[model samples]
Every structure is written in C-alpha cells, then in structure tokens.
Target chain A: MSNYLSLENVGITFKTQNGPFRALDDVSIKIEKGEYVTMIGHSGCGKSTVLNIVAGLLTATEGVVLLENKEVNAPGPDRAVVFQNHSLLPWLTVYENVRLGVDKVFAKTKSKAERDEWTKHNLKLVHMEHAMDKRPGEISGGMKQRVGIARALAMEPKVLLMDEPFGALDALTRAHLQDSVMEIQAELGNTVIMITHDVDEAVLLSDRIVMLTNGPSATIGEILTVDLPRPRNRLALAEDPHYHHLRGQVLEFLYHRQLRPAA
Target chain B: MKSNIVRLTPQQESPPEESTAVIPESASNAASTATRATKSVEKIPASTTRNYALWRASGTTLIKNIFLPVLTFLVVGVIWSYIHSHIAPEIPSIADTWTRAKEILADPLAQNGPNDMGIGWQVLYSLGRVLGGFALAAIVGIPVGFVMGMSENFQKAVQPLIQILRPVSPLAWLPIGLLLFKAVNPSAIFVIFITSIWPMIMNTAAGVKAIPKDYMNVAAVLRLGKLEITRKILLPATLPHVITGMRLSLSIAWMVIVAAEMLTGGIGIGFYVWDEWNNLNVPSIIVAIFIIGIVGIILESVMTLVHRHFDYSR
Candidate 1:
C-alpha cells in the first residue's frame, strides 16, 4: 500500500536575532493510513516542528511534506491540530468552540442539524457533552483538553495532529485522556501524529514511536514499532514483558542515545 | 435555599465521577464527602445552617466593601470640616456647603436662563459632551488602533505623532478646535475627543499586538478567513484591553470636559463652578466641587462594571 502521509527530508530553519537556527534537519518519515504515530524527543528537539510542518502551521525551509500524494503547503481542515495549550476561545462555550470548526468545515456540505449532530457527537466521544454550555474559563484543564480534541475530531480531518495535548494536565487526567484517545483512534481508524515527551504515553498509544535526536538540528534517531495488541490496558501492560521491552527501547533511544546537553 | 442545596449536592457529586474518575481516589473522596454531607443534613436542617453561613459571609463582605469605605469618608469629612473652620475660613465650611447644596439641589432642573441653569442641567450638559466626545473617539480611535496593530509600517509611521501629541494639554487643543469649528460646543467636544483618543488608540494597538500566538495558530490550522479570525479570535481576545482603554478614555474625557467647559463658559458643572468662583460664592463652588467628584466617581464605577463584564481571563 502507498504511504498515507510522508515527510521527505523535511528541515526548518528559523532566523533569530542571534543567527540562523536550524530546528529540524533532514527528517523523513512515512506514515500509513490508520496509523497512530508519535514523535518523542527532549524539550527542544524539533519534534513539534515536524508536526507543524505536517499541519502546515509552519513551512519547511528545505524539504517537502506530502499528504495523500498532495503537497502540504498551508493549514486546512484536512489536518486539524489540537494545540498543547488547548486553545479554545475563552469567549466561546465548549459547544461553540467545537461548533466553530464544525460549521467552518461542514457548513456547505451538511445541513444545520447535521452539523450540530457532528458537534454533539464529537463532544460525546470525548465525554464532554455535559459541559457544552460552560466556557473554557469555567471548565478545568482536563475538560478544556477534551474539548480541544473534540474540536479537532469534529473537523473529520484526514489526519489528526496533537501537540502535547495532555502535557499541562495532571497524571490521572493524562492517563484518562490517553485511554480516550486510544479508543477514539481505534474506533475511527484515522491517521494521527502526536508529539509528546513522556515515554510511557508514547508506548501506550502509538503504533510506531519515532524518536528524535537532541537539537540545534534534530532528526529522527530511531523508529520502534509497538507490537502490543489492541485495547491495551495500562494495568495489563504494566506487567507485560513485551510492553516493557518496547517501552525500554524508546527509553533507551531517548535517554542513552539522545541525551540533551545540560544548560 | 433548601431546594438549592439539594440540587447542588447531586451536581457536585456527579462531575468528579464523570470527568475526574481517572484519579479514583479523589473521586471516591468526593463521594465520601457527599455521604458526609447527607449525614450532616439529617443531624441538622441543612438549609438553616447554610443560610447562616451565607448570611455571615455576606455580612463580612459588606463590612469590608461598604462599611469601611463609608468610615473612611467620614474621617475625611471630619478633616475637611476642621481645615475649613480653623485653618482657612475663606474656604467654605462643610455646613455652609451642605446648606448651599440643599438649596441648589431642591430645584435642580430649574432654568432661569442658559447662563443661570440648575446644577442638574449643568451636570447633564457636561455628561452629554463627555459621552459625545468619548463615542467619537471610540469610532475613530479603535479602527486606527486596529490598523496600527495589523501593519508594522503604519504603527511605525503613526507612533511618533501619537507620542508627541498625547501629552499636550486638553486646553491646548481648545484653541485649535475653536479655530477649526468656530463654535463653542463643537470645540469643547473636540478638546474632549483629542484628549481621550490617545489612550484608546495606544491601548487597543497594544492589545491587538499582544494576542497570544497560540490563538493565531489555531486560526491558521482551522483555515479561518480574515473576517472569521477577527470576529472569533481577535475581537474577544482584545475585548478586555479595549474596555480598559475605554475606561481610561472616559475618565480623562470627564476630567478634560470640566476644564474645557470652564474655558468655553458653557452651561456645565465646570462653568458653574467657575461662575460661582467669580461671584465669590465659596459655598456654591464647594458644592460644585463635591458634585464634580461624585459624578466622576459614578462614571468610573460604570466603566469598572463594563470592564468586569468583558474581563474573562480568569
């Protein structure tokens, strides 16, 4: 089968006051349809840069990004990004935040009722239907992230991009959201590219973990395919030897091989 | 009250279970609290106790917010009375001013002529001018600010002019306004508009420039059009700052209107005070000063309410 999404030697250089800054260099990855791929690295390792390139929020300075045989040049509804900060408009309620994107993408194609259904259905998927009337300010951090996910999913994007969606959340909230995301991915079979620093998270969710080297010009250091079975329980995987082995590989790649320089 | 507590208890119990069950310990802890609350309800009528707690809380808040301020005002009044009676008898005594205030306020809408109108008419006239000038500033200044914020070149071009002109006195603009309009009313409004426009423009520009990058990123990823971006993202994000600018502009406009009216010799509180000063009516001038202060306070409080309504960052 053809690759669903591919980045062919993508690199991004930002011109800062100090000088030219190479955030990513010669990074290439091929992701198949329905794949849950996560890019994991240290804080400044250009993992987010890779995701942004695919999302078309940032243009690659050197190489090209392809989605289903088309060049990814600008942000569109095809690739919906769940920002790390859960960037829900403060003035909008949970329902309105989700509906904003839903209406934008589906207003012409679908009826008002259908669009509303899509919004409510997506919020239901994230179990955020009850707090639909509440604004982002009124809700907790975890709820806001759930709404962010709902907003992204409501677009029915060909590829879902999440940049540390649960990084700001507490451990329990993170674990719960991770489980929800895993279930959603399984059910929808949509392609996903998530950026995270947590190893256990990467192991738990991703079909493939793409590890990156430490930066100035970061690139893919290793790719580990998680061979674990579906509906992977966190408790069950805690004791499973194969899970540990896969988790250990990611840890080794991140810590031993690509150790970040001390500031 | 009883119904409210009963309704609140179930809502408080269910949210943690649905949203926060990832931390089962906290979930169960919340459940235990709900049970404990039920037990307490059986021991004592929950409504009465909750009502007492509510009453106590509100009582304390009232004391802090209202009573303390009133007490401070009383202290200031005593000091003012002492100063007027002992230090400078030429300055109207508090009692004398109170007497004049009573006489003037008894028929506040009375109009013998344009020059000899009641205190109410004077205050209303001043307020009308302030609002007129303030509205005009908002109409012109906000858009200018939007342009300044959106375009770096425009901002660079206009910023120097704003800085140079902002500190010039409102009275300085009066002559220019009189020359251009050749009318007292429009000139006064012109002075008010010029004085107030700077804060609105500066604040709105700063606010637009300070929009969080994350929101802009969201706009980009969603492929939102320019109009949609401004309507959905930019406007709401800048609302707090815009309201702040409006508040500053209003207070400055109020301050400038009085000075402008005093120069223009119109039927306003400022002109009324100046008239009283000329006639050596110290008690009437004192009353006018109090009215000016009270009106200023009311305008500021109204702006504060508006500010609080739009302030959603919390």
Candidate 2:
C-alpha cells in the first residue's frame, strides 16, 4: 500500500565520464500526511539525491514515487522547496520573491487581491513583514532563509522540501529559524522532508530521523523515531532524557556505524 | 526614563562593516569641542571644512583629480603646437582646430544640401544609424544569447559559428551589407550591427551561464512557464549583463560607424571626416575627431549609468 508520499526502491546511477556511478540504491520511504521527516547523513551519502527524487527534480532510474497517490514525474508546485542558500531572487524585493511563487501557483485559485493578501500573509507568517520592500541582497542571511521558507509555505505544497535550510545560518539564527519552523509546522501540520547533517536539528524538528550510510551506493541505514512530546521546547528538551536518547541513537548511527574518514 | 548605555546591532557593532559616513557624525561632535577649545582652527568653520581637512589627510586627491588632468591637457596642447610648427603641415594647430570647431558650432543645424549639412546633422545621422543597428542587434542578439545560455546543445552547435563570424572585420561586413541591402545607409547600419552583436551575444550568454543553479531550481519548483521564467527570473537576472553588453556594443558601434560611413560614403561623422580629408580641410577633420571622441564618451557614460542601475551582483 502506498503512503501519502512514497518512494519505492528508488535509486539513481549517474553516467559519469569514468563510468556509471551509483549514487543511491534501493532507497525507500513512506511518508504520511503531516509527517515531519528529516534525512541525515554525511555530505556525499545521496541524502539530497533521495530528496530530489521525491520532489521530482531528479527521476529515479529504478522505481516509482507516488505523491497523493499520483505518479511523480517532473517538478511541480506541489513539491515546493526551500533551498540551502535561500534562493530568493536577488533582483526582486522580498515581497516579490515570495509573490513570484505565489502568483504562479495560485494563478487559478486566488484572485488578484486574494493573491496579494496571501503573499503579505505568508511574509507576515515568517516575521518578514517589515522587510517586504527590501531586496534579497539587502536582507540578512537568516532573514533571507526566513523569506525562503515563507516562499515555500505560500505555495501550500503537498510536501515542503528543505535541503539544509539552516545549514548556512549561524548557531543562534539557526535556533531561531528551527523554532519558527517548529511553530509553523505545529500550526499548519505540513508534510516536511528536510535534509540535514545536524543530529540535534533532525531530532528537534522531525517525527522520525532517517539516517543513510556513506555512498558509492548509499541506502537508508536506519530510521530512528523521536518520541518526544511537543510543543518540544529546545530549553526543556535539553533536560529531557528521551530527547538525549533519540539524539544519541542518531549520533551512534552517524559517527559509530556510518563513519567515513575526513577528506 | 531613557537608558544610559546604548545597544548596538551586529551591523553597527562590526567596525569593518561601518560605512565612512558613520565616522563623520561622531567626529563632528569631537570636532565641535576641538573648535570651541581652539580659536586657531576656527577659520575652517563647518563639516565641509572638516571634510576638506579629512581630504587633506588622504592627500593628493586635488593634485591627482584636478591639477594633474589640467596639466596633461596643457602638455597635449604644447605637443600639438610643436607638431604644427615643425613636422606635419597637413595637421592643423590646436588654436586653428578650435576656431574651426567654433565655426562648425556657430551653424550646427544648417541644411544647405545633402553634403553641405551642418556638423550636428552629420552627427545626428551617424547617431540614428548607430542606434538603429544597436537596437536591432540587441533585439536579435539578447534572445539568441538567452537561447545559447538556456540550451547546452544549442550553445555548443552555435559557438563555433559565432567564433568564426565575430572576427570578420566591419569593412568586410560592409561589402556584404551593401550587397544584401543595396543601400548606403543600411549598409553602414549593417556594419554597426555586425560589429556590435558579438559582444552583446557573448556577454549576455556569459551572464546567463553565471547565474547560480539555485535560481533555476527555484524556477523549477515554482513550475514557472517559459514566459514567466523569462519575465520573473531570466530577464531580470541577465539585465545587468545585457546593459554591459549594450555598453560594449554601443562603444564599438560608435567606433565602427565612422569607418562604416566613410566606406559607404554617406551622411555621418565618418563621411564628414573623409569629405574634409578630400577637401584638404585638416582643421575640420581635427574637429570631427574631437566630435567622435565626445559622442563616444556621452554614449559610454549613459550606458554605464544604465549598467549601474541593473547591476545586482554588487
């Protein structure tokens, strides 16, 4: 039986000049509606490849991906992404950057005023209402990422794909973003698939943390469930043993089992 | 009650990031006290004077910016006078050239006949042709550049053709343009078109290539239509580069128009310069040279402003 979003035996083999290099193999995940999942691994472990396949930005050579019980073939607005570097268009103001997606995706459903309201609403959701007129270049990195999240959220996609959304942000900024994301996710109940290297981030944000082994042919090594109760306050969770246990399991999987030498 | 200690945001706290303007307000406060304490420094007066003092601290700006350039111009005049006195009788002296330039300026819009039109008319005619050719080149080349950038196979297929055609001289294209259009004006315009299009295409394509993959990925996720992508993403992203291409193309077109009009034998600065040579009017030819340089500077400055407006990379 298929889940809300399912990747069954998904794999990719790139045709490089050297030869065919297998990046991922036999990777499968079944995501339910409103489930927040984080994929964690070393940099080259096909974590992004897996995310890409689900988002239909990359086609899996081996198997199928079903989103809302339909075959996922090419990229669509249904799988809106928050890119690592906060890919807000530098040329457009923060409002227009989000509105660029909002205008296109909601072209059919939303009226002009409704669309405008929706754009402002989404920008407000990310605490970026004051900077609506500023270009992406004018904003801070954390702020840009907030707008990136706002842009993706405005689409109201079936699945929100974040490829290391907080990777480029500072520790404090990352915590703020993580908290905001948690707050947003709790309110909206949006299905999220975030790829991250931070074990604590994965545990804090995800209902389940899917760990992957190192590549040549990377696949899911283990899936660790974080059974912590929410609204999971980071300060409160710092003292919670269950949060520590869940974090430890993910850490054990990464450093102990899936260890690769520093290149 | 207001707080005694002020908190600085990270932006303000970072000394390296602080703009020079910030230093002035703080310095002015200290400068006011210093001015009050000492009557000797009172002659300088306000912030403008303080800025001048700061300018002195930097040193050599006045000499480098103003004095040196004036000195250079005087040196050039001296050299021109020496050359006029000794070597080339064909070359007019600076004063004679200036007088001829004044005569040309006196009746700039005179329309006596086709060949006996004023210097302004010739310049205008040349400008019209350059603009036409430059506009056509932009309309054609910018889209071609976009196509080349968007498609790898197209870029590869067309790269060799562009390389081969780009280096073919403006004079060489003039003959081809004459044969094709079989008209003098169009032929000159065509030479400008051929000379200018390469930089536009190359620069625009480079701009398209320089865009980060993340942007296209955002487009992909949005499922932006081809037209929407162009309007919302591609066009704006490549605009600064397009302006740069236009700037380069305009300058080249300005340079080539003189040669182009000379070859085609038409109404332009190029033709004027050539006709003045035929008449042995060396002073007028010197004036034409100055006109060419002036027009080029104006076109270049306008385009540079446009480039700065669109340049998001900075």
> Judged by TM-score, which candidate is best?
1
lDDT of 2 by residue, B34-98 (tens): 44433544454654575566445334433344466579789999888888899886688888888
Best-fitting candidate, scored by lDDT: 1
Q: How many steric clashes between backbone atoms does each model show? A: 0, 0
Compose the digit string of candidate 2's lDDT tens values, residues A1-263.
44799888988999999999999999988998999999999999999998888788898999899898799989988899899999888888999988888888888998999999999999999999999998886678899999999999999999999999999999999999999999999999999999999999999999989999999899999998888888989999999898898898988989998889774
What candidate 1 gets wrong by more than 4 Å, as runs, is B1-60
Query: In candidate 1 chain A, what residue range of length 10 has the lowest lDDT sum?
Result: A254-263
Error of 1 at B179 (Å): 0.7
Model 1 agreement with the true structure over B1-314: per-residue lDDT tens digits: 34334444543333311222123443344445545556657656664575465445444544555566679889989998888878987887778788988999999999998878999999999999999999999999998998898899999999999999999897898999999999999999999899889999998998999998999988998888999888889888898888899999899888888889989997998898889889999999878888888898888888887997888875
Model 2 / residue B291 / CA error / Å:
1.5
TM (B chain), model 2: 0.82
lDDT of 1 by residue, A1-263 (tens): 57789999899999999999989999988899999999999998888889888999889999999898899999998999999999999988999999999999998999999999999999999999999999898788999999999999999999999999999999999999999998898899989999999999999999999999999899988899998999899999999999999988988887787777693
What is the Cα-based lDDT of residue B121 in candidate 1?
98
Candidate 2 chain B: 10-residue stretch with minimal lDDT:
B1-10
Per-residue error (Å), model 2, residue B297:
0.9
For candidate 2, the docking band is medium
